[model samples]
Target: MRKEPLLLLILIALILAPSVQGAKKVVYVAKVEGTITEYTADQFQRYIDIAERNNAEALIIELNTPGGLGDAMMRIVSEIQNSSVPVIIYVYPRGAIAASAGTYIAMGSHLIAMAPATSIGACEPILGYSQNGSIVRAPEKIRNFYTAYMRSLAEESGRNTTAAVKFVTEDLSLTPEEALKAHVIEVVADDVPDLLRKANGMRTKLPVKGKGYVVLDFTDVQVRHIGNSISDVLISYLSNPAIAYILLNVGILGLIFGFLTPGWHVPETVGAILLVLGVVGLGYFGYNTAGVILIILAMIFFIAEALTPTFGLFTVAGVASFIMGSLLLFGKGGGSIYLINRETFSMLRIAIIVLAVLLGLFFLFGMTAVVRARRRKPETGKEEMIGAVGKVVEDLDPEGVVKVRGELWKAVSKTGEIIRVGETVKVTGMRGLTLIVEKAEGDAEWQE
Candidate 1:
């Protein structure tokens, strides 16, 4: 009987053990689009942290970007290289690209996948702006650094180092087929489901600091898509070059309008906040000090005009200065090396011209009309006759005629005094067409 009980206990424990130890497969999918910046880096880290905390089988980054700042890219690479969970970078959705900094980030991942028609490469580094406002490549020294960095990523990821080096030097781009053939990418799939199916049980090495590599088993992992949080979406939008530029100018205009119209604290406060944010947006790429100075001078001119009403002279000057300042703002290097293109520059120039012209017209004519209305004297009525003195056209016998203000009027004497035809009379008051006159004193000349 005792032996039977022991056997029963062992059987029950064996049945329960598999259920207790089996872990569910969980894959985290993080979507990355637009220009990579500090916001992107931060959000990427957050995704990884969440995945690791959840004991995820893998973290997949869906990447589609034109590139971004070197610092932000490198930070993202570092985060990926140091992550405990395996990171799979997938260029997805049938026509996405991973260019410039995006190429660097994709290489840093444990595995890279692509959807149909997706592409990669074009890792050349654009250093900064030339004096003529065109982009220039980095120096040989910088080029070498990038070449070696890319080569390292290729070597560490077990991809083609030679081809990767060419990507930096020659700006060699690759289609999905070309990348796979060049050994730059592992595989291509139509969608996430297909990607997971293909990537399952794939062999890959994960980096562990100091210690070499930790092989991860990715067999039968269940994939799950994680949408961006509200903050993530907002940051992504704010990081857009066009949007950031608009915000910056809007802030400047708001502040100027507030200052011009005194006692409007709302616009001023909102403008201050926006200006600060705009500066921060510019900081993401980098700003030219010279450009910033020009913009400040423009603002000064605008403010001076508002305070002293230069009748659009200062306004016109300010507009001109602002256009110049805006042109030079990104002349030095910043985050997105190729962020400002020819089309963007042209659009900005046109916008500045239009805005300046509109503002000039408003201040020049609108404000003038308002001031004139406030100071104009009444042209007709009793107010016009109150202090008039004129010559008596006919002798006034308590009711005679006088010429006042170049117009004839019948006179009624205030003191019934006789006024000669050549004598001047003072208009004391008026009733209808008659002037209430008083005799002019000695040497008093009537001015009609």
Candidate 2:
């Protein structure tokens, strides 16, 4: 009887041990709704940290993005691939997509799910600009390398290799149902609750840091949302092509205006901040170094115009350089990597050229007028005595007072002439506010 009781106790303990030891299931849902940026990386890492701290069962990322920088995308993929918890990428809430770098990220996850009407695919490599307003596409070899990389990622996830290949080779796209049928994705869920329910009891493989691989079976999953914060949303908006373009323009104009007026702290501050942000965006987007250099040169030209008289040469050069630089700023990354469109470029170029031409003409005209005015005879002050006919206000043997411009001034005769106070005289030169006078026409009392 005692041995039978011990066996039954052991059997009950074994049955309860699994329930006690199994990890509590909690799902973290992180949403990516716009352009992927460095900030996005930070947000993802933050959520992962939260999930790990809470010992969450898995993380579900609902991605809807047009695309973003390659480096950022790669970093995100690396994070997801190396995560301790299983990550599920879902194109959810309907009308969402996983395009460009989004596709890479989705494929990097442990599982990929899409909502009805959602789609994913389209991987293409884009290049930076050159110096002279030209767009250059990446070499075929490099493009093929990326294509192969994407293909490998897809294959690793057990997604359709053919469809993934078409994404890069032909830019193919498929709806959520089609993606499921094509093996590009696992399931379709209409919303987060449905997604969590479907994801429950799913087996996942996660690569531990030191260990090779660990199998995790999710049970009793509970969904927790990780939505974007206000700051993250703002950063996402600023990273957009249109917003970035506007910021760049405003920054450049602010800096220019500040330089012209000097001591305008607001514009200068705003300009500096925006310029730094714009540069960060440019670096993130892989703008051409040559084009960036050209922009720097254009700024130099404009500065030179403001500080020195360049006869409009610098202004003209600056305008031309700005147009060319802006044109070449973003290369032929197709729709994939382009920060600014062709129409935007054309508009910016025309606007800059027109503004520069007008400013240059104004500077030229104002400078010419100043030069001409200086060359003309002085109309007032000590300068007015030059070649002026005046009268000796006092007896001037060699030095005395003379009247010029209704004012009396110390006078000296350059021709060694003496004159009475009432005598008329002429001013030939000046020295320290002293007029060098000579006898007018026929003044017999004063002679050389």
RMSD to native for every prediction? 8.3, 9.4
Considering summed lDDT, which 10 consecutive residues are worst modelled in model 2? 332-341
Top candidate when judged by lDDT against the true structure: 1
lDDT of every model, 2 decimals: 0.79, 0.72
Please write out the lDDT profile of model 2 over residues 1-448, one tens digit for every residue. 8899999999999999998756557778888877677777777788888887877777888889866777788899898887777778888778888987888888778788899888898776656434343544567997898789888887776678888888877778888888888988877898877776676665543354433354444456666788778877667656654455456656876787787778757887898788877776565445655666676787678667666655678777876776566555664333223454455455655665665566556556754665566668767666665667777878888888877767778889887767888788887787887888887786433322
Location of the lowest summed lDDT over 10 successive residues in candidate 1: 332-341
Let me know the TM-score candidate 1 reaches against the reference structure.
Answer: 0.76
Give the per-residue Cα lDDT of candidate 1 at 340. 58
TM-score of each: 0.76, 0.68
